[model samples]
Each structure stands twice: as structure tokens, then as C-alpha cells.
Target chain A: MSGIRVSLRGKSFPDASGNGTRQVLGELGFVAERGEFVAILGPSGCGKTTLLNLIAGLDAAYEGEIALDAAAGNAAPDIGYVFQNPRLLPWRTVFENVCLVLNAPAGATALVEKFLAEAGLTEFRDAYPEKLSLGQRRRVAIVRAFAIAPDLLLMDEPFVSLDGPTAERLRAMLLEIWNACPTTVLFVTHDLDEAIALADRVLVLSESPASIVADVPIAVPRQERMAPAVLEEFRKRLRQPEKV
Target chain B: MFHLHAIWPRLASFFLFLLLWQLGAMALESRLLPLPEAVFAVLRDGFQSGEIPHHIGITLGRVAASFVLAMAIGSAIGIAMGRSRLLDRLFDAWLVLFLNVPALVVILLAYVWFGLIEAAAILAVAVNKIPNVAVTLREGSRALDRDYLEMAHSFRLGSLRTFRHVVLPQLSPYFLASARSGLALIWKIVLVVELLGRSDGVGFQLHLYFQLFDVASILAYTLAFVAVVLVIEAVCFRPLDRRALRWRR
Candidate 1:
């Protein structure tokens, strides 16, 4: 099983127009148990992306400790990230893009085919990412992340800006993959409804220099998450996390 | 058959060029402005005797050597400079200096320092061409999209794989651009290097013929060598560039 222990004390960047530093993340700590799905819900510019960067080890300049516990001991956890944009290597085809996430690209190509077929992208395997529609590209990105059976998966508003029907379909596919893989996931989004629909627990954060304001566990059952009445009940509980 | 649309214009352009040259030659009626037929005859004889082919081969060899040397060294420096702020700051002045320095001065410097040897000729042409390649590739590296790099980093793709897949493909356009311009620059520089120093290349032959004022032979060598370089461009580089960046819209 995969788990994470992140304790970020602070992180900052140079302000654009001033000679001062602007704090982005501060005094934030959280734990994701093995096989758990946790979503970080915050407003825009609340350092949610910055938090993901630190946890993913993309930014190692943070002030505090962020440790990952993979199923395999004494090795760095394999982290799969689904960015807000698909971010596929434009030159490589869809299949190659997924295969690139594997440690052994040549030998593990069968895994790529399997994932593509499961995601209904087998026919577009050889097509370049530029040729795919937004929904199709998002599907490829999800498939790439789950194909590796990563120790921890980080997704940053992966379904942002898609139409209603398209976003719903991709979210369904994402849940299916996560259920099968059962890896620790840290999903970041500004949309509260999305968090309520997806995560086992939603960790709410405050404005810039963000810290956890509320940690609300979704009381709705997984099968009934989409039911309008259940979602309404959950929304009332998170009605205002800013004062929590 | 489908390429006929593209091929027809090129064929017409060539004939139009020849017709204009013929008309000029007839109007001039001087020993220097020889007829196309006379130039072709000289070219045919030179080929039959094998001296022109020998000279052509030598010039092409120098061009290939210097082109490869400059590109390899230049691309490395360019990439390094692009990635590191310190390297860019340190090398920026040197790049501008070399770029401004005249090619003839570089050739002369090479001859003086390294002597009139084969290596010196190649080195002169190479140093003259390196700065341009380095500049192009440096811009390419600077313009590299962070989104793809972050993707590579988050996936923990090793340095080698990251470079081969994410980095190289992004730089393909820059590489192709450098190579195309590099080939053009190296051809002219190699000819000058041969003319200035070496005794067995097209440039040297041109020099030898100039002393005797053999206009027909000079025109024939110039035209024939231009044809060969054109063929290399069309047959080698253009297709490779198209294939390398086939995914681009």
C-alpha cells in the first residue's frame, strides 16, 4: 500500500512588481493513509498547485519535510501526476506518451495497449496528441497516470474547463482506474462540488499562505455520490469552510 | 504523381533561368560571358578527365567535416548555456564577439596559428560557423516549455530519458533550423578555406583557372558545384526535417 506524510511549514516566491517575497503555502500538514483518496479544496491562487509541487518533489526548496511511503521500502516512491493540462509530449503519439511513464518502455508496451484499450483510446494510439480532442487527451493523461501503478498519484484540476458531459465521463473513468489501482491520491481542485463527488475526504484551505481550515470527510457512499439529494446534504456541511 | 504539381514549377524555374542566361550570353558576345553549351562542354570534359570530380569530392569532404564538428560542439554549448544562468552570463559575451568577428579573419588566424594544414582549413570553417548554431539552439533551449519539463519531473523520468524524449523533440525545430543554415554557411566557408590554403579542391581549381582567365571552366565548376550542393540539400536535409517534426501542425 502507498501513503504520504507531508508537513510543509512555508513556501514563497518573489513578488512580480515588488522586491518582497510573497508567501504561498504556510504551516500546512496532512497525512494520506495507504490506499486513501484525499482531495485538497481551495480557492484560486490559494497555493494548492504549489502544495502539489512540493509533495510531488518537483520543488525541493520548501521549508518543511514531505515524506512518501511506497509499498516498496527504501526506494523513492513512483509518483504519477495528472496536470491541469494534458501536457503530453507533442511529438510523441498517444501510445508512446503513456509508454514513456513506464520504467521499461519497450518491454512494457503491452501495458500501454491494455490501458489504451480500457480507456477506449486504442484506435487513436498512433495519433499525435495534437490530433486528439480535449476530452480524448484528458483520457490519455488519466490512462498514463494509472498505467504505472504509481505509489502516489497527484492530480491538479485535471478535468477543468471541460463541458458537463465530458467532465462527468472522465471523472467516471478516473474513479474506475483508482479503484483498481488503489494508490494514494492527492487531488487538488478549486471546485467544491467536484471534491464532494470524488474524494473520501476534502481538506479545505484558506487564502494565500494557505493552511488547512477544515477537514470534512464525505459522509456519502461511493455508489450514491452522484445522487442529487446526497450531494445537497454534503454541500450544506461544507457551506462555509472559511470560518471552520 | 501527386508531387507533379510541386515539381512543375521547379522545372519551369530552371528552364527559365537557363533561357535568361542564354539570352544574356548571346547579348554580351564576350569571351567571359561564354554560352551555356560551351560551359557544359567544359564541364563534360572535366568530368570525363576526373579532375573536376576529384576536386568536387575534396570540397564536399571538407564541408561535411567542418559542418559536423561545428554542429556537435556548438549544440552542446548552446544547450548548456540555455539551461544554466551562470553559463549564459559567462558565454553571452563570447558568443556575440565570435558572431561579429569576420570569417576571413578566422580563416587567416587558423592558418597563422595552425599552419596551412588540412585540419587548419576545417577548423577555420568550423569556428566561423559555430557561433550561429550555438545562438539558435540557445534560444530554443530558453523557449523550452516548462509544462513538459514538469511532467517529466513529476513522473521521475530519469535524466537521459527526459532529454531524449521531452527535451530533444522540443528542440528538433531548432536543430533543423541550425543544420539548414549551417550547411549553407559551411559550403561557402569551406570553398574560401580551400581557395585560401588547400591545393586540391574546387576552390583551389577556381583559383588556378582564374590566373589563366579560363571563363568557361570557371563558370562550369561554379554551376556544377552549386548543382551538387542543391541536390544534397533537397535529398538529405529537407526530408529529415519534415520527418523529424511531422507532428507539428
Candidate 2:
């Protein structure tokens, strides 16, 4: 089991002019249960990505305790992160990109092939990132993140700008993989529909210097989340509360 | 792959350059400027006598030694300085100073301090090239995409693998840029070192030919060395460049 607990007092970034500091996140604390999918939904430029980065232990200048515990007794949970962009090494092939993170290559070949096929990227397994289309590249990024079977998977708007149909398909694929692995996923997105559709719990956040505005739970079953009626109900109930 | 259509323009360019040189020589009609054919004939004779071949071999060895030394040490220091703020602040001033230092002064000092040995000569050439390589690679390291590095770190791809897989590939274009210019700069510096101190090499032969006012031999030696450099660029560097950058396509 993997879980993330963060209690941050405040976080600020130096302004572009370099003479002043702008506070980005003000008192924020949340606990993600083991094997839970928590979607952090906020408006654009609401310090959503910064929150994910801090939870992923990428930024250490914040004032608070962030604890990641693996119930399996590992020292620290092995994290798998998917950025908004693919960020693949252009010089490396798709197979090589996944293999580099495996660390133990002897038994990883079969696992890599399985993940590629699962993501429907087996045909593009040897292709470089530049050779793939934007949608295909995002698929590869998801595949790379899932192939490692990470204890904690943090995704920062992995499907932000993709066309709706492709994003829908990718979301289905992500659910299939996460269902099989059951890792703790902290997904950050601006789309409330996406958050409700994918996350077991949705943490609604305000604009910059962000703090939680609501802690939403997806009461509908997973299979029914995409149904028009259920989504309509969620939109009316969730949006009316925050007027977002 | 070898398109005949692409070659004609290149061949014509070469022909135009030679025609210009021939016209200039004829217009001058001086002992200083030899005809292209006369220089070629001198080159043939020099090879027949084995003197030019021996000197060319010595110069090639010196150039290779200095090139390897500079690339290794410079890349190491460059990556270190690029990654660490402390290291960069400590060595940045030294790097700038070395970059501005004259190659002539460096060669003179090396010879004086190290007694004009072969080691001193090679050291002088490498010292001249290191700061340039370091500067180029430092920019490459600085421009490394943080997203890819973050992916590596999140996946727990240890530091060694991160450097090999993430850092090195991004640094390659910069590495190649420095190497191409480094070879050219080292080629010029090595000759100067040999001319100033060494009893052998093409530079020494050129010095000897100067005493006799044999401008034809000097021109011939220059043409042969240029051909060598061109051959090396075509046979080694071009292929390596294409392979390294094949992914860009």
C-alpha cells in the first residue's frame, strides 16, 4: 500500500523581476489514502502543478512535512510521474526510454513489451518522441509511467491539450492500468469533468495562493461515471457549490 | 545516397576557387605566389623524398594527443561546473581568464616552464583548447531539459544512469560543436608549438624552407596538410556527426 500525507504551511516563488516574492500556496494539507486516486482540480495558474511538484518531493523549499509511506516496508515509495508533456529523450527509442527506468534490464524486456502492447504502442515501440504525434507521445508517457508499477504515480495534466476523443480514450487506458496496479495516484487537472470521471476523491482548489475550497467524493460507481445522467448530476451538484 | 546532381555545384565551386588562385598568382608574377601546378609538383617531389610524409605523421600524432586530452579534461570540468554552483563560481573566473589568454603566450610559457619537451608541446596545445571546449559544453549542460531529468529522478533512475541516459545525450550536440572547432584550433596551435621548439614536423620544414626562400615547398606543405584535415573530417567526423544526430530527423 502506498499513501501520501502533506502538511504545507506556505510556499512562495521569487517574482520574475527578482525583487519581490509571490506566494503561490498558503496553508495546504491533505492525506491521500493507500490505493486512492485523488484529483486536484483548480483554475488555470492556480498553483496546481506546484502542489503536485511539492508532493512528488521535487520542490523542498516549502515549509511543512510531506510524508510518503509504503505499507510494504520499502524505505520510500518509488514514484512514477507523468508531466503534461511527453518529455521523452528524443535520442532514445521508446523501448529504451522505458528500459532506462527499469534499472534491472535482465527481466524487464518482457515487462516493457507488455506495457507497450497494453498502451497500443507496440507498433511505435522503436520510434523516437519526435517521430510520434502528440497524442501518441502522451500515450507513450503514460505507458512509461505505468510500466514501472510505481507505488506513487503523480500526473500533472497529462492530457491537457489533447483533442476530446483522444483524451477520453487515454483516460480509459489509464483507468485500465491503474485498476490492475492499484497505486496511489495524485492527478492534477483543471477540468472538473475529468477530475470527477477519474478520481475517487476530488480536491477542489482556489486560485493562486491556493487552499482547498472543497473535498469532493465521486459517489457514483466507476462504470457509471461516464453516463450522461450521472455526469449531469455531478456537474449540477459540484459546480453549484463552488460556482466554478 | 550519392546524388550526382548535388556534386556538380560543389565541383564547380572548387574549380572557381582554383581559377581565382591561378589568376591571382599570374597577376602577381612574384616568387612569393607559386602556381597551383608548381605547388603540386613540389608536393609530389617532397613525398618522393619521404621528408614531407615523416613531418606530416609527427604533426598528426601531436594533434591527436592534444585533442583527446583537451576533450576529456574539458568535458569533465564543464559538466562539473555546469551542475554545481560552488564549482562554477570557483572556476568560472579561471575559465574566462584562460579563454582570453593568448595561445602564443601559453606556448611560450609551457616551453619555458617545462623545458621544450614533447610533453610541454602537447600540453601547450591542449591548454589552448580546454577553455573553449569547457565553455561550449557548459552551455549544453546548462540548457539540459529539466523535464527529462525530473522524469529520471521520479523513476529512481540512479545518478549514474541519469547522467548516462539523460545528461550525456543532451550534451552531445555541444560536444560535437566543440570537437570540430577544437580540431581546427589545435591544428593551428600544434604547428606553432612545433615551429617554435621542435626539430621536426611540417612547421619545422616550413621554417627550413623559409630560410632558403622556397615558397613553392611552403605552399605545397600547406596544401598537403589541408588535404589531410579534409580527409579526416570526411572519414571520421562527418560519419560520427550523422550518426549522433540521426534522431533529429
Candidate 3:
């Protein structure tokens, strides 16, 4: 699967009050090569979400140009976003919610069933979202994001607010899907270890009115990504007082 | 099978109401307040002659017509107002004015302008209900979840799909609320419109009986119409309400 090249230059949003504007992204520019997974890590209240919003085209009230250049053979690069919450339509059953994004065709039923099974939600496919546990809802959201076969998938802390085991399980599920159907993923999170474990490259941002402080690449092999020594070394390098 | 345990309380309350009315009639000892037995006899006579059913049918048709019209037009206007600031500002004053104006005035004005036609009667009833439905749905639209809408956008769900999946579910409760309240209000207003001008309806029958001091027949018509309204509430609305809100369980 081909990827997308996202370029943003000087994105800014004005404060709600008539005060001066807040510079969320200051001449920020990055590109995710085809089929690469990039994690954007920043402190809380930073413009991590704002950056994702710009790329996802959710927030258009920003300065500078944000462009998505798709690779050849892909006409329009579809984007799938997983918000901090699952954001499922509570009235719809799990399967129906996934079907909401798919262009209606007879083949959609099989596609939905395949994704539901992949996410361990086959048994709960007919259950309403309100009846599912939070982790299950997040799993459904992940399945929904992948169902559309997006070229650029954006996730904003999809595992946030879950218990430790649930979050870990969801992360593992995400990796399994990513491995199966490779796509350009732009994941936003505040967790350092999560960024290290999941992303090919970690881009750290400064505090509010953020800009890229460091672009750290995890050179360790994929199998050893979570090794204690490797994780300790990266943590030491990222936490240097001079980086901020 | 019907449950006697569930129905006994309602039956007992109805009987108690009838006993109180009978006592009041005995105390007045006047023709103005007929005894329950006399009213029931008139009701039986009206049913045998088929006059009461025909008039009841006409009034119900008006109620249904007005209810559907008001909900459709009001929901459209309410959603428009909620989505657009310009429309909301333009219609805010007009909505408040219509809401406060007496239903009697609107009905009389409609009859005067439209000349006592079915269109005028239905329009009058619908006008009385539109502002209320519009107000309730406007709030619903305003409170719609932006997060879900954002999800739709990110997934590239088109306008129609977004509305069906994201907008309608959130608005269903408001729709149901407006429908319930609108039914109650429209039936009452339709009766007023019928009484003021129409030739055949429960309202017209009551007007005719009023001139002759036929207290028993008037009470009988009132009782019959109330029973029809109660049946609609139980048979049509209650089941639909349960189905629409089944997701809550």
C-alpha cells in the first residue's frame, strides 16, 4: 500500500477571546514516506491534536498550507481518524457502526465481518456500543478506521484512559492490523514508551504553541523495540535537559 | 391475554370518577349536570345511529393531518435554524411571537383568511404546534455531538450518510418529544378550529347540543372523544415510543 506525504507550514489558531493568536505549529513540516508509521509525541496541552486535526482536515481555521500528496496509483487519499474517545454512534450496533463508513455494496458485509473478527469483536458485532466495554468500543473504533482502507490513518491517543492491560492489548491489536494492511499512520500521543514501542520514528514537540523539538528515530530492530536496555537508553537520550 | 392485575387499578380509578360525578349530579339536582347513566345512554344512542363515529373520524383525520404537517415543516425549519446563525437570528423573534400568541387568535385568523375550508382548519392547528416543535428540535440540533460529526468527516462519510448515522440518532429523542407534545396540543387546537367554524365534528356536535341544553349528549361526545385520544396514546404512540427508544435499554 502506497502512503501519503503530509506537509504543513506555519499552522496557527487564534485564541477564542479576541486576544493574540496561539501558535500551535510554528513552520512545522514533516513527511511520512509510503507505508511508514510516524508517532507525534508531546506534552499534554501541546498542539499534538491540533497538528493531527490539520492533517485530517477537521480544523481548517489555521494559517499556512497543509497538503497531502498521495503516491501514484492512489487518486484520493482517504483519511481515517480515531479520536481520544471511541466516538461510536451509540444507537447503532457494532457492525452497523463500521458499515457507516463503507460505501454501500454487497461486498461490504464480508469486509465488515472480516474486520470485526480481526478485532475480536465478531461475537459482539450485533451489540449496541453502549452495551460494550470501553476497551471493546476502542477495538470497534480501530476496526472502523481500518474498514475504509484509508491511505493515511490518524489516531489521537486511541488507547488513552484505559486500564494498563486493556491499553496494552489494544496496542498489540493495532500492530497486528498495521502489519496486515500497511498504511501511512500518524499517531499522536503523550506517552513516551508507547511512541517508542509502536512508531518507526518519534517526533517530540515542545509545550503549548508547540514546534518540533527533536526527531528521534528508533534504530533498534522491531523485535527488540521493548527490550529494557534499549528502552532505558532511548529514555535517557530523550529526557536530556537540553532537548527542551 | 390481558393482565387483570395490571388493569384493575385503572378500572377502579375510572369507576371512582364516575361515582363522584353521579353524586355531584344528585346534589345539583339540575339539568346542567347529567348523571353518568344519562350520559352513557346518550353515548349508546349516538353509537347506534353512527353519528358519533363519523364525526370522531373527521376530527381524527384533521388531527393526523395537522400533526404530520407540523412535525415535517417544524423539523425542517428547526434544523435549518440550528445549523445556520443567519436563519436562527432571522426567525428567533418570529418564533417567540408565535409561541406566545393565543391559539384561539390563530384559528380565528386562519378561518377569516382562508374561509372555513379544511386547509384553514389544518393550517390553524399546525400553526399552533409548529413553534413548539421547532423550539424543542432547535435545542436538540444545538446539542448534537461535534465529536461524532468530526468522525464522519474524517471517514469521508457523505452528507446523506452523515445525517442518517450521526445527526438523526441524536435528534430522535427530540423528534419523539416534539411528536408527543405536538399530538396533545394539535388535537386540542383542532377541536377549537372545528367548533369555531366546521360543520361536522365532535366539536360541531357539542356546539349543536349546547344550543338545545342537551347536557347528556354534550357530556357523551366529550367522553367519547377523550376515549379516542386515550386509545391513540396507548395504541399508536406508546408502542412507537418504546421502539424508538429501545436502544436505551
Every candidate's TM-score, chain A alone: 0.95, 0.96, 0.93
Candidate 1 scores an iRMS of: 0.8
Better of 1 and 3 by TM-score: 1
Model 3 segments beyond 4 Å from truth? A71-74, A241-243, B1-3
What is candidate 1's CA lDDT for residue A205? Answer: 91
Candidate 2 chain B, poorest ten consecutive residues by summed lDDT? B149-158
* Tens-digit lDDT track of model 2 for B176-216: 89999999999989989999999999888888899999999
Error of 1 at B127 (Å): 0.6
How well is each residue in A140-222 modelled by candidate 3, as lDDT tens digits? 99999888888888999999899999999899999999999888899999898989889998888787667777888888876
Segments of candidate 1 deviating more than 4 angstroms: none
Scanning candidate 3 chain A in windows of ten residues, the lowest lDDT window is A1-10
Cα lDDT of model 1 by residue, B1-249, tens digit: 239898999899999999999999999999998999999999999999998999999999999999999999999999999999999999899999999999999999999999999999999999998999999999999999998999998898889999999999888889989999999899988888988999889999998889989999999999989999889988988888889979977
Per-prediction tally of clashes: 0, 0, 0
Pick the lDDT winner: 1
lDDT of 1 by residue, A113-209 (tens): 9888978999999999999999999999989988888888899999999998999888888888788778888999988789998999999999999
By TM-score, the candidates rank as 1, 3, 2
Docking class of 3: medium
Q: Which candidate, 1 or 2, would have the higher lDDT against the true structure?
A: 1
What are the per-model DockQ values?
A: 0.87, 0.75, 0.79
Backbone clashes counted, model 1 = 0
